[model samples]
Target: MKVGLGLPISDPPSLLTWARRADAGPFTTMGLLDRIVYDNPEPLITLAAIAAATTRIRVQTEVLLAPLREPVLLAKQCATLDRISGGRLTLGIGVGARPEDYLAVGADYATRGRRVDEMMPVLRRIWSGQPHDDQVGPIGPAPTRVNGPELLFGGFVPAALKRVARWGDGYLSAVPVERTDPLFRMVEKEWGAAGRAGRARLVGQVNVALGPDSVVEDAKQTIGSYYASLAGTYDVHMVTTADQIRTTITGFADLGADEVMLYCWAHDPDQVDRLADLLA
Candidate 1:
């Protein structure tokens, strides 16, 4: 299975350093969390920086809020990033759930799902270079590839799954241990309905921790707040040793996940090294 590293975009200095490190490591892809007003960097800008610094690692926005921005503009930005990255960009999009995020961006949270549905066709049109009165003609100087970046839709709701079937090239799911079967079932159904059963990719994200007592304790202290809200839900973060992580990742692959993005909540750079070793 393809492995990706999820960096904390909230810390620009550390994120940049980690991106460079990950580029030199075994990771095939690097992902950034998208949060406009929260404690995260703007994904496109961060991705652009990563594209400039790395030569091979594919860059991804592991769930950008599509409903908050104008589709055309976002599409243009993604296309530009794809060009810079030599077509190594994957645009992971979702209708954000946080009401405060929507309010902060002056978007109605209730209308986000509908807005995302409306924006997707426009975004795809922009990517495909289809002439549209609403879109910027031809998407600028052209992308590195004929199509723009790969588009992945993320969310757990049935409506979200339907949207993935209708509009996305793949599904990005954060599957809890209990919900894994249902999530894969929905993805399979959607993929079949979209006529993309084998074509569509499945990328799953999981929280991980590795090493001895001090290391584990340190990781918990650093990432505990970030996962505090997801303690019991399907979003429950997993804290496991390196061996456990390898076993779990293998399980995900067995369940048809094409790629698994490891979100290491630990701030230590050594954690990435440990993860790379464990995965190896």
Candidate 2:
């Protein structure tokens, strides 16, 4: 199983530092969380910077809110980033959970899932160097990969699983394997049913922060605040010690995860090295 590190987007300035550290470490990918209304940096743009700074680590949006932006524009941005990253971009997308994120963009919250269904094919079409609108020319800067960046879909719903089989290269899970294992099986069933050759990739994400007392406490506070709105509805999944991190990775690997992204909630760049040392 491969291990990946999630960027601390809460501290924008630390992104490049962390990315470079991850690149120099055993980490295979550097992931980012996405949101429109939050104080965090935009995933794609921040990832572009991270790509420029790091050579080996793949840059990914652990899950970008796909319905918030125009599909054509999103395709262009992702294609451009894929080129900038030397084909090391994984486009993880989903219909986001927060209504405020959609409301801020004037997007319809209720129709997001349906919109995502409609948009996936269009994104593929654009990436195929096909003109999104026949009236306009084909989008330029074609993706490094034949079909665009490897797409990973997120969400626990049946519709989300269907999207993985229909349009994505994999499934990205934020939930634990107890919940995700069944979903992965369903994805495989759907993938085979769809006649997609081979199996869909299974990616997992866990929030982690390892450092001094202050750093761990800070991570707890930051994460708590981020999920404040969802309070009772959301459960914060964070591990603050090296033992927990190792255990989490082993558990996911045993569960058949292709890659596990360790989401760093604290904004300390040195946390990258700390994680690397622990992993080493």
Candidate 3:
């Protein structure tokens, strides 16, 4: 399976350093987490910088909050980044959970999902340049890829699976092992019914913390706690030793995960190197 690294959006200095390291590492792709009016920097902008710095590593928004922005504008931005990245951009999007974020951005939280559904088509239309209201031809100079960047939708529930089946190139699973199997089956069924079976990518998000004398309980207190809050619910968080990391990844590969993005809790540069070594 292809492995990717997630940058720490909470720290700008470390984010840049990690981006460079990930580009040079064995990781097939590098991803940035998204949030607005949060602690992190803007994902697209940071990705643009990484694109300029690296030559081949695919850059992705692990998941961008789509309902908060104008679809056309976001399309333009993503297209521009894809061009700059030489077609290495994968746009992962989802409806954000924070109601305060939507309210702050003057977007209605209640209707964000509906807005996302509508926005997907508009974004595609803009990218394809099929001609729409008040615009002539397709948007230019167009993305580096003819079809524009790959769109990956993220969420763990049935509604999210349905959305992926309806309008996405893949589904991003960000839950624990128990939940993932069911969601993966749901995606497989839905994709087959949609005639997109075996065509859609399946990416699993796993939290990682590896070292000697490091117990699962330690990971639970640190990484697990953070992800639980982010996921907005308490669920099993996969905490394992360095050896177990490889085993878990293999299991996910067996489960049909095309790729696995590691959300590392240790922000130290050394931890990045250590994780790379363990994965290698």
Best by TM-score: 2
Question: In lDDT terms, how accurate is model 1?
Answer: 0.77
lDDT of 1 by residue, 32-100 (tens): 777665566788898899889988999998888888898778878888899888899999988765677
Model 1 RMSD to the real structure?
2.2
The local lDDT score (0 to 100) that residue 78 gets in candidate 2 is 96
Model 2 clash pairs are: none
Q: Kindly report which residue stretches of model 3 are placed more than 4 angstroms away from their true locations once superposed.
A: 134-137, 211-240
What local lDDT does model 2 show for residue 211?
Answer: 96
Q: Is candidate 1 or candidate 2 better by TM-score?
A: 2
Which residue pairs in model 3 clash with each other?
A: 129-138
Off by over 4 Å in 1: 134-136, 212-215, 227-234
With a 3 Å backbone cut-off (N, CA, C), the pairs that clash in candidate 1 are none
Worst 10 residues of 3 by lDDT: 211-220
List the candidate 2 regions with Cα displacement exceeding 4 Å. none
lDDT of 2 at 16: 81
